[model samples]
Target: MKLQDQPPLHLTYGLSIHPDETWPELWASIQEKALAVRARVAPGKAFGLGLRLRDAVSREMAEGGNLRRFRQFLDENGLYIFTLNGFPYGRFHGGRVKEQVYAPDWRTEARLDYTRRLADLLAVLLPDGVAGSISTVPGSFKPWIHGASDVERITDQLARAVAHLAGLKEKTGREIHLGLEPEPGCLFETPDELIRFMQEWMWPRGRVRVARELGCSLAAAEQKVRLHLGVCLDTCHVAVCFEDPEEALRQYQAAGLRISKIQLSAALEADAVGRAALARFIEPVYLHQVVADLGGGRLRSWLDLPEALAALGSLPEARAVRVHFHIPLHFEGGGGLRSTTFALRPSFFRALQNGATEHLEIETYSFDALPGGASRDVVESVAGEYRWVLQRLVRAN
Candidate 1:
């Protein structure tokens, strides 16, 4: 069978690796990194980019003539955008992004506005007859929500966002879905948490609210909610949470939740004996949430690598520690650290075989933070990641 005859999947590398907050800087990064990577990896094929736009850049691009120029640039470069990384609303690098990454969570109008803008931008940028996806933060950081009222507010905000997406679809005829990404230490971190949020809060109340807003029946409204709101399965995050990707994908499918995009990435895994070696990853720029799988199906979680290291004495003995570090997808074993790359293959293959998701984005956003990553050629590393993932997908088919 020919490669094109196999399952159709859109493969791209997330542009979040480039920390360009403005349009000029962003375009430069794309020219320097994205184009270079595409040239080396994809060559003649029309490459897709998982664009990551900050709030400022989004606004600027939305201005008169800017987005058009960008589209022209993509056309000239043989590049197209099918997915966006809207998870971070602001600065993601060169500073302490830690927990502040989830600042304007789904509970606020700001989050809604930002996402709506993204949808609008995507509607224009998305190629004709191609669907687009925007991956966002999962509600809020778990620690920030005080009680049921906070959760209620989040659901209300999400309902509004869904209504906005429905309107976008009505206006542009482009079906862009919001993928609520579940990360470690976030509100809906675990698979169970995500499932519960959709079933309990989103479905029960969201359906009615959406029904009222869209002037549709409850069943139709529920369908809209399901179509608009879905999961962005980040392999690094899921692996860090000790989730068996196959089982998690099955659970999402069984629950009727769409996997909008699968972020092809890897997490750092270290056994108890190799725990000391993980200290190198305890940086201050990003929050490296760690989960240690304790016996009897219990897991001990920490907010960051430091907290995990500090509580090492108090926590019970664990099998392995999965750190929420976006390592290079191409390289698996190095520096006494093993990658969760192994988990990605089975999950990715199964998802593709089962028609789970069409968008597959290589999202190694922490390239700057990785060891030796600073000195390495960013284009080469990203291109290598694209090559690695594409090879796997081809082999799987």
Candidate 2:
């Protein structure tokens, strides 16, 4: 399994990890793992980097003269900055290694402030030699204002963030697009809401026909906005919303929206008895519904993960999708643990074997919060899990 043998479309696979462990130690392990992945499948296409939302060290590295070190690290390791995941944005102050930084109080002002800092940071972090770039999430800004006026306010704030990112792109001499992700409980939850907001509030002057009809643009009606705004496209978010993924993706395409990033996660759907039983152990967020072959007697994890992906691959102009994998964890004795709690099923492996996809990312970031989750062993555990996933994918391919 070398790079040349893989499908032409399967080049952008990758993963994400917190920068809590020492960078030298983490980089060493990551480089070795990525190189092994490259050697095994699609030799030269090293898994890109997903700078998690809570990596203050990486964020700091994105600033000051240290950015040279960071850039050198990417070059040396064959990785690129994909997206800065704004995690733990809610008010949960305690739980895992990330909870402390997960500022749910992240209002629009706080997010704007973070974005400003991030833009400046990227000015140094991602210049030439970088593959692609993305902006941080927009802080909730205003949760109470959910109707038209709230949408309008969010639009203005988002526009400002995009313009700022555009300026960062100009300074860096690279096109770093900022994607506004709609979380499950956030203001911009539905795809329709995000699309509408982008049209009226973000780019009122209108690039699409829908925008032109609304007469929305305020400052520069004739100016053509590049529409750097788009959706993050998380599978879990879509699944939780109970939207038909294939249909949702089509609507997004029809609206002329770009899927800036794709979060690939599995939603565990249980059968009648199992659903009722599992409901007793975990909350609904951790539980979802799925179909089962009464004859086969197996569980259905992803209602349409494969179907959604196959549909995506069929689209000629769809945005590049980045896989975001989340491993399950159990809390015991006031701690956490991450192992083979959830592994990629055979059906998904079969989908990959049939060449039904492009990218694969290892995203088990909450590992540090698992029961007995000591930071000392997290990277090793996560790196091992990464190796396991790669081996399975290669074997299936």
Candidate 3:
């Protein structure tokens, strides 16, 4: 038998590690942090950046002179932004974010307007012939959707955004897309749930609105919506929900859904014996949704680690629990703690090697929430993760 060659990998590696809350501060952080990572990780090369623009900073970046100024900075530094973390619309750090992160969800005009601005900004930033993607919230927070009106509102809003994106592509001659990211407790926690929402509500409702708005046939509108909007598959989120990344990828592929990007990250996991170590991760800054498998396909969840800990005595003991803590790719926990990196099987990497998705990001956004992360040099830590992923890609080839 003869060996077949692997297809060429058109992959880009990055870290969505920006944590600043203001424009000047963010610019300084990018100039310092992004450049330091580049110098250490891909010296003298085009380093791909996963830009995190807060709502205020997004406005600032769009204002006069700043956009061009930032583009000049990118040119000088040999850094390129290939993706934006659109999930955070405001105040990402230095305050308690919690579930408020999912506010102004897909049901509102605010979410649609903000997403449209990002699409406009990304279309300008993307290099010629390079497609762009923005990962956003998965509809609304699970607890907030009270009835059919909310679902209908979100469906119509997203369809409007999809229509706007199609118009942007036609006007700019660039393809900038939106990827709804699913979290453990969000409206669409699992790939199965997300696809169900898409087929049942989004596709059926979106096609009509999109077709009417674009003055096109229903079939063309569905195709356009699918092309411009898709899944931003976050490995950590899916793993924390007790789902395998490869299996989720297979599900997405089977459903005729597009994977706009893949956030390469790992979640923390521990069995009954290692449960004590999870206490160190409880913090005030962000919500860390926890999911536990109680055997026999029975699963339970809590909004945060503390709630899970508080209810542990009353509920049946779980076989294992996974935390939505974005652990560094290179870190396998000691002291009875482990990461869900094991869930990233060989098939996932093989799919990447075959261009399953064009965008790959090292999204350790919560490194600061990890134990001793504040004292660690984030740029150096991210650079190590960049090496970890690059080496894996090399070995996979």
lDDT of each: 0.86, 0.45, 0.84
lDDT of 1: 0.86
Give per-residue CA lDDT, model 3, range 1-397, as digits (tens): 0012243223344434665678888787778888787788667777667777877888999999998988888878776776888898888778899999997799888888899998888888877767789999999899999988888888899899999999999999888788989998899899999999889887888889999999999999999989988899999999998899999998998997888989999999888778888899999988999988899998889999999988765665688889999989999787778989888766678788776777888888888888999989888888888788777766775
Give the clash count for each candidate. Answer: 0, 19, 0
For model 1, the superposed segments whose C-alpha errors exceed 4 Å read: 1-7, 314-316
Q: Which stretches of candidate 3 lie over 4 Å from their true place?
A: 1-16
- In candidate 3 the C-alpha lDDT for residue 90 amounts to 87
Candidate 1 to truth, TM: 0.96
Q: Model 3: what TM-score?
A: 0.95
In order of appearance, the predictions have TM-scores of 0.96, 0.60, 0.95
Candidate achieving the largest lDDT: 1
Residue range 234-307, candidate 2, lDDT tens digits = 54455545454545565676777655554544333332332222222222111122222323333222222343
